[model samples]
Target: MVVQQYRDGGGARAVRALAVAGVIAVTAGCFGGEGESGASDGSGRSVAADRPLDLLGRAADVLVEAGGAETRTSMETAAGGTRVTIRGQGAYDFRRQMGRLKVVLPEDAAGADGHRPITELLAPGALYMKNRGAGVPDDKWVRIDTTALKDGNLLTGGVTDPMAAAELLRGAADVTYAGKSELAGVTVHHYRGVADLGRAARAASPQSRGALSAAAKGFSKDAVPFDAYLDEDGRLRKVRHRFTFSSEGPEVSVVSTLLLYGFGLPVTVTLPDEDAIYTGEIRQG
Candidate 1:
């Protein structure tokens, strides 16, 4: 779930809209199954038996070289024994740090017709949303300063930024080669570890540093557990990160998953004009 806090007049107001709902509850699950154990590292040695911190750390660099790719994202959160998953699909330009996604919220969040797919533009430090319900006009866009979000828009956007997700791996530590696995008909190397968001911020590119740095401090903990899959070419084919937020009542758990494919795809993202942004008060749930 997503929680958006923006300043109106001289005070800040929190909007718990259905499209960008605030965190309620979540439960983290372990990563296991799928793929064999003790796979060979191409030299008669078991790759899974070795810790490949360097390989995991370079995952972002590899994506940058790939130019761009089509992306699919899934975020699952549970509240009061009910779980909802938000799904998105789009393309991302890794080099430019820009992308476009159409995110769909579950029907239960809104009435059947009200849960229209929201168009989101992901840029350096801001997020633009269209069809963002919460007393928002259909023709106007809601612009959010990602830096101001407590989670740095990581969890607030419902879908994690693909580029940011890859960059987070730069701080991978205590990583272990899980084994070889087949994802979407392609073989990939699976690795599991915990990433230091603070370290990743320092190593991230200029476009992502500030947002990641803010995320490092906003989350319940800086160390985020993840499962990353990279192909032989070193490109990040898939990644899953578990985040916990404890700023309010109980700790909230969120599982963010990103999948990348169709490399070298052309992607175009344009930001909205100042006049197109909504500056009025956003109604709360």
Candidate 2:
């Protein structure tokens, strides 16, 4: 067995994340049965392609009418080419004044018991991560704080910037009408999008100008562009993306599983290592 014992330290968190990422990709692949290579017919044939969307820009407008949560798995690779996977659970609830998501690792994750993870709430523009575990504090979590992270659903958060997430996919090509398939039982049409990190870094921040100035400087030169596959309808089912760091190439495989389609308002996020919980009335403005 390739047992990587991660002792408590700076490297422990990263190692744990990387190990779990590998397992989740393998597991998600088995569950959805979708991939870059579209499904074939009995005659060894593939589905026909759809027309390009130059008129409206993208093949479809998932962000056209926003009001629900979208959930899926996520995999992020490192600059040194290390793959890290996370079972992403996310939602978009404008009504709740928030859109949020969380990634949970399966049992096999090296430090599954020690690594702290939690919600980064988009409602109040505050970070929310799960830190309350077997014996951990409730506030400790690896995070990047951002008010825009709470602005809109991550799916369309960069909608204004078509090529924003292009660099997220490394050494990968975008396929238009690559094929049609079902994810979480929902049929969606697929399209591939790409943008250079240099170009992406120049795009304006949808929320504000000052923040964009700060974020633009740190943009990586080689962020892998992502391959987003949608069903016949218009929902993002899967993204074949690997982090392409200026240092490392395509390093992670992320498969997103979207369930309970629609908004996750009053979304029920399960607490780890616990079976009991409670809540008070959701005070809203």
Candidate 3:
């Protein structure tokens, strides 16, 4: 962490500048067993290739066959002089482009009474959010017509889709095998590399693609540093990435971790009642 101060020309006013770097760790939770684990056969076979890019491709294949996965993501961000932390748990159906999620907010983000978790359900054409205990009607859910979005705003909302995340695994550089380790009671291979954000932006979800495209204009084309773990079945158990972005003054650093599991398992998603939905509501940052 580093901080700098600048005195305005009036001398009576002063402005402080800060730059912070942090690593946010996201924990993995099991839903149901659906597939095997590891890049190499559990018996005694060794990895044919140690390249991170190659291993990512194998992970991508396994994810495709698995259909979708359950994930828990946590992010900590600091910019200017403020810091915010967000954590969420969810399940996404890659093939169906659907998901259900619950996001936990920090105490500082609470309303007049207190903070309450927000529940969300997303699908191809629609998105619904329910803010439990937020002084709203019990059955009143907010709905957004996803197909009507002219610009992809939903993707940039800090939600990670399993398929979108898998697509961004390509074009890795500075690959290094960090050896093997135990993740969630299972032995796995650990690897680290730089993620190609340009490629990732193009492959991410529509909202993320648009957000990345705009954000990229103000930053370098350098790859973001990332770490990943693969199981015996060549499946990606966890992946983490961290990067800093700057434009004119303050710089903001973001750390994102994605966990993939419950492969080939069933994910049941039921939308809210139409009569109970408020279609005009929008989430505010």
Top-scoring candidate (lDDT): 1
Report model 2's TM-score to 2 decimal places.
Answer: 0.50
After TM-score superposition, the amount by which residue 76's alpha carbon in candidate 3 deviates from its true location, in angstroms, is 1.4
Query: Lowest lDDT 10-mer window, candidate 2?
Result: 23-32
Which residues of candidate 1, in runs, are more than 4 Å off? 1-42, 46-51, 111-114, 247-249, 281-285
Tens digits of per-residue lDDT for model 2, 1-285: 011111222333333434442211111111111122234455655433433233113312332233354645454433234444455556644333344565555445545564544443443222333432433244333222232321112221111111123212222234355555565667654555553333333442243222233323333333334456544433344555333213132322322223325532354432232222111111111
Instruction: Please give the CA lDDT of all the candidate structures.
Output: 0.73, 0.34, 0.54
Backbone clash total for model 2 is 27
Worst 10 residues of 3 by lDDT: 12-21
Going through the candidates in the order shown, the clash numbers are 1, 27, 8
Alpha-carbon lDDT of model 2: 0.34
Off by over 4 Å in 3: 1-49, 80-82, 111-113, 124-127, 132-140, 143-155, 201-222, 272-285
Q: Rank the candidates by TM-score, best first.
A: 1, 3, 2
Tens-place lDDT per residue, model 1, 75-190, is: 87643344567889999998888999998887766545567888889999988888776556678777776775666777777899998898899888888878787999988888
Candidate 2 stretches with Cα past 4 Å from truth are: 1-61, 76-84, 94-97, 106-117, 123-126, 132-136, 139-144, 147-175, 198-205, 208-216, 248-260, 263-285
True-structure RMSD, every candidate: 8.2, 12.0, 9.5
Against the true structure, what is each candidate's TM-score? 0.83, 0.50, 0.67
